[model samples]
Target chain A: MAILEVKNLSIEFGGLKAVEDFNLSLEKGELIAIIGPNGAGKTTIFNMLTGIYPPSNGTIHLDGENLLGRKPFQFAQAGIARTFQNIRLFSNASVIDNVKMANTADSNENFFESILRTPGMVEKERQLDEHALELLSLFGLEGQADTIAKNLPYGAQRRLEIVRALMLNPKVLLLDEPVAGMITTELDEMAQLVKELREKHGQTIILIEHHMNFVMPIVDRIIVLNFGKTISEGTPAEIQKDPRVIEAYLGGGFHGNA
Target chain B: MKNKLNSILPPVVLVLIYFLIQLLLSKKILNPYHIQILMFACVNIMLTVSLNIVNGFTGQFCIGHAGFMSLGAYGSAIITTMLFGGMKMDPNLRIPVFLLSLLVGGILAAIVGFLIGLPTLKIKGDYLAIVTLAFGEIVRSTLRLIEPIGAARGMIGIPKITNLAWMFFFVMITLYITRNFVYSRYGRASIAIRDNEIAADAMGINTTRYKVIAFVFAAFIAGVAGGLYAHLMTFIQPDSFSFVKSNELLVYLYAGGSGSITGSVLGALVLTIIPEALRFLGNLTNWRIVIYAVILVLIMLYKPSGLFGGKEISFLRINRDSFRKPFNKFNDPKLADKQNS
Candidate 1:
């Protein structure tokens, strides 16, 4: 079943429409990729999907529930999460602190419990620490758990973004250009991680990727956008052969060779 | 046993130290003027810590804290004069009524904070700050216009129920509650919003809810401090809680280091006492204010983020490590038995 369905999504800025008549129906556990040129409004669509920008016209339904008129946190509560294109993190906080903040979404303990240091609250706090450490370990970030987030190397920062996003345990994860700037090794590791998320955790993913090689092999399906409109949609093999995609976006597609 | 001893020792030591100060006061070793200054330091600590919750941790610039304080002052003062009518009440009855007045003042300020915060907090940073400053001014002018509450001439002959003990108790409560709030999920969520609102919201944190909570809680504590201030001076005045009072609290928070409880303690305690220390210059009481301003400027130059530099001392960190094992032992019969045995 389609876990998320957007019909005729549209948004405008000033006089120009940033994204128009966009349509998407993502199945549960499916890995879908949105590909386009620099100004093709890919990020804009992600922004709308994640409730950062309210669409001028369209309906976004997650799990058959209307996502319109809901706050970003409410969208998150409905099991949708996203990472940023520019990597927004609590830069002053430690790496573990970043993950811990997001992990709090599921914690139900109150401040009184914290004040009195109740046993259950303490155990829950320990669990939170363990869970955050486990995630950091998965990303090879356990050693840097105490390091301030902005001090980490660029690659680590990118990885930490995913770690923070995953902390929400979202059913549908929207990763915006997850591997925008990465070496070959980091790109491969991220690709493997993305696949693992779907295969192991059954996480439904919608990704925006500029790297052709990264987007081509991993995604079950490809969505090509040009000039704020859906130019083509099909399997990667089909998308690779589509003439409109070649002329509009591919032009043999941009690849970083990772 | 060492851990148990360590846990029990700090509070015991704190009580002993507290009593020593009281003993000195009772013996007249410490003059009443000195005691008054010290008590005022404790009250400033409460106000500073409360403001830090909103401005420092949540990253909102709230300059209307004095407005909440004023509300609390007036709320409790009205109760004191209306209910008890005079300062010559029985000691036992006076203590409870004073405590009750603190509660009334805190609740009244909290309600006003909710009303103001709900509409203003939804906007951007600068706008929220402007609105808060405006709120403070509005409260001040409104109080001035009202005839019954003594207007600008001030409410006189109020009960002077506040003392060192009362100040100490409220200060500790403020510190304890703030420390707990900072380590809690709601507190982390507030910090997250401070770091990045969009990202925090994407992670399923209700940013508006946390922001408002922090604002209201800060206001409540500030109100309680205000009640203490009114009773401490035995007077209530609208002009007492001007923009200057709000700015003074902010200065104390920044000087101690925002986001650090120990810093707030150090900042408020020291800053409150500095002007009095300068009085030794003799007939230059106003020069103390001038020197205080210069020191603040120097502080801004050399230690901009404040003395602690945003690093918390964590003596009262709710030590999750301490909380974990023994606390859980209560739930597990086997663990409890093992400990007992």
Candidate 2:
């Protein structure tokens, strides 16, 4: 059964249509990649799916529940989580604390518990801290937990973003340009983490990626977008041979492999 | 063990020093006028430190801080005046009553904050600021229309209970609580939202909930300060809690550096003492206001981040690295075990 389903999704800003008739279904523990040229509305699709923007039309279902009108945070609580294209790691905070904030949403902790520091509160905090650190360690970030997020190297900041999202323990994870700024080695490490995140954590992952090499290896299937609509959907090998996919990337004049 | 101590030491030391100095100054060194000036300084510290939680850490501009203060002052003053008005109680008992009243005032102010914040959560940046400022004005006008509290005549005969000890004690508590909060998980969420709301929300943070929490917490502290102010001045007036007073507190937070706890404390202390130090400009009170304006503008132009620029300062070493030789590693297995378990 599909874990997340989007039907006839459309988004318009003022008079302009930014996304139209976008549809996709994600199954449990599956890794799917959405790829397109610039302004193909890849990010817009991610935003709408994550409740950053209320869709102009259509409905989204998470675990068979309607999800069109909920706020981004409400979506998070409903088991949908996302990370931004730009690295947003709470720059002034320590890396470990950055992930710890995500754990706060699901924990049965409150202001009184934190301030009073009762035995229950202490135990809860300890468990949260451990979980957060384990996530950092999964991405080889345990050593950087004490450093200020912004002060870290650019590659580390991007990794921190994924680690933070994972802290929410969501059923579906949405990543926008996870490999946008990484060096090749960093991307490879990120791929390993993403693969582990799916296989071990059992999270269904949807990523919007421009780097075809990164997407081709990890994604179970690929969706192609062009001018705010889904143009093609298939396995990686099938998407690579589609003529429209080439046109979307390099205009109609060129003939090349995707 | 050392790592745990490092996280909790600064706020403790700062509060201890504040009370120690208050005790020493009251006993032998300072006169009543100086004591009054210092009392105001403590009040300013509470206001600025609390304001920093929203304006600095959460990145929300709140021009309604004085409204929260008015609610707190009125809430506590009415309770104090009504309860202790005609009774001949021991002077010592008044302090506890005053503290209790302050806590009550803080809670009420937090409720008002929640009410205002509910409608304004969707608004951001300058627009949100205008809404909050209008709330402060609304409170001012409403107070003016009320008659039982004397309205324009001001609420009078509030029993004076804001001694040096009480004022400084609340100030210390405010500082300690705010400092601890900044280092905790809530603090990180607040800063994350402040740095980038969109990203914070995407990371599964309930941004609206955290924003309301920060605003309410800040308002509560502002209320406590207002209570102390009412008792210290021995008068309560709507005009006293005006936009100018809010501006005064904002100036302190901005000049101190937005995210630095120590900076807020220093800003309050320095700004409080400056006008009195310039007593030579007696009839030129207008010049004092001009100078204050100039100083604020100059600081903004010269140091946009203020004096400390969002960095913590310590007079003594608190981190374990200070004692451990060659301790440059970013992570320690032992530290990780301690944090986890």
| lDDT leader | 1
Candidate 2 TM-score, true structure as reference: 0.88
Q: Which 10-residue window of candidate 1 chain B scores lowest in summed lDDT?
A: B332-341
Tens-place lDDT digits, model 1, residues B1-341? 55566546655766786799879979999888998999889888999999989988898889889999999999999898876774466767887888899889999999999998898888866888999999999999999998998989989877898987777777767876787788878778888888888899999988877889899889999889999998999987898899998888988999888888888889999999998889998887879999998998888899998887678754555543454444555655553454344
Identify the candidate with maximal TM-score. 1
Candidate 2 residue B18 C-alpha distance from true site, Å: 6.9
What is candidate 1's CA lDDT for residue B118?
Answer: 90
Candidate 2 lDDT over B163-192, as tens digits, reads 777776677677667865675557767888
Clash pairs, candidate 1, are A250-A253
List per-model TM-scores for chain B. 0.90, 0.85
For candidate 2 chain A, which ten residues in a row score worst on lDDT?
A249-258
